[model samples]
Target: MSREPYRARWAGTDYEASADLVDGRLHLRLYGSAPADGFEKVAPGRFVRAVPAADCSAVWHVTTVCEWHGAPFLVHTAREAELLIEYTGGDALHAAGLGLERIERGVYRIWVKREEVSALSEKLVKIVSR
Candidate 1:
């Protein structure tokens, strides 16, 4: 397993994350604050209207797992929209020789061969760590 750091722009926002290639899977952990609108945009309309953060805004925590080269890659799933945007912009799967598909609204999936995936993962780790 190798640890790597990556930064990119998503949904007009910048994010930082650490990635690891383990057992042929790419594991990602994203770090960032919640959107300016806060939980009002994320939570149900009724819930947001009823409950507002008076003292402190709600923080965001997202976790997602995707298959990479037949291996499962676990990712911090915060910033759903932003992550999709970045993926489309060719940041995550760029040059990984992976096939990208839109699984659903604001969601995407990637497919790649094991050898290519391993090579790309190593390259990404080196680039980000530098």
Candidate 2:
């Protein structure tokens, strides 16, 4: 990925989510509200929709994913606030490189590797002594 993973962070929260376009398709991975199905056309060049938590499984992780192939457009939504992402040229992935190097075009392989790290961060906690 690039410096920024095409994401949306609202209200100084770490639970920000991001999205990318793979071969003219939307690949959204976020830990908040599940994006709505399809965009509602508000005007000739505007669309609006909601990414609500419609199911139990969608409560966490990236739950919203869609595919669109045309002149390209933008998705405007939020988790607890408003966010925006434009699906246009360069934003869409044409190819990817994994273990064996660059994979073929239009081929997307999702290999999620999970590792266990106990002390990953140090956050301030309110300590009360009695």
Candidate 3:
């Protein structure tokens, strides 16, 4: 599959970093200092740098599950995937939820939509700022 690169402004700098899929792996890199504020992806190939409110007590962020190795286990926290492993019946729903697209003997990725991430983050920020 053709993957696009994700870009975002480093935690506190104007410089941006690129997160790309290299050899079927997520490779995030920048030429300067590391992101101090940390970051999370809001969408596929899109990232957002966290901005903390004054005296913020907590930080809200989303995580991506690119690949997992659990031998018929693959839990993706991003997009819609499937579990391509061998499992017994009466638990199809439970097993399928273990994958993002298709899990086969463990190994895959996951990504959430931009709208969901943005909305969730916004809600958390409001609560934290209060």
Candidate 4:
């Protein structure tokens, strides 16, 4: 069966990210950095994908699992992804109740509440500004 594409949006802003799940994994392709107050481009990274622990690295085992619509999604789903975002400390949305939904084949949608987005954005700004 084919999976759907996924999209994620930050509340109160045009900032967003998109990815797809193929062969039981989600692929997040980072194009540009978000345009928040203190968002800094740490390093130039390319396409990264997330997959089930059985298929990917064993490190993914330590990540948390989030449940949405009775489905469990992995937080920091991928090792490389987790490190990349952690370096910048900007992708903390995963901890702020970010929700993901499969919209259609190879498509998925991620939603973050306005309040949480604001708080995350502020935290990122503080870190970057320092």
Which candidate number has the best lDDT?
Answer: 1
Report the C-alpha lDDT of model 4 over 1-130, residue by residue, as the tens digit.
0011222222222222335566766543222343333344545532232322222221111123344433334333223223111112223344343333434443344543222221121111111110
- Candidate 3, run of 10 with poorest lDDT: 118-127
* Reference-based lDDT, residue 114, model 1: 34
Model 2: lowest-lDDT 10 consecutive positions: 113-122
**Cα-based TM-score, every candidate:** 0.21, 0.17, 0.20, 0.18
Model 2 over residues 1-130: C-alpha lDDT tens digits?
Answer: 1112233332232333344465665444334333334545545644333332221122222222222333222222333332222232332343222221123443233322212111112222212111
Candidates 2 and 3 compared by lDDT, better number = 3
Clashes of each: 2, 1, 10, 14
True-structure lDDT of candidate 4:
0.29
Please list the residue runs of candidate 1 whose C-alpha ends up more than 4 Å from where it truly belongs after superposition.
Answer: 1-49, 55-58, 61-67, 70-96, 102-130
| Residue 12 local lDDT, model 2 | 34
lDDT of 1 by residue, 33-128 (tens): 453433234333321111111211221222333444444354323232222211333344542444556565544454433333322221222222
In Å, residue 128's CA in model 3 sits off its true spot by 26
* TM-score of candidate 1 to 2 decimals: 0.21
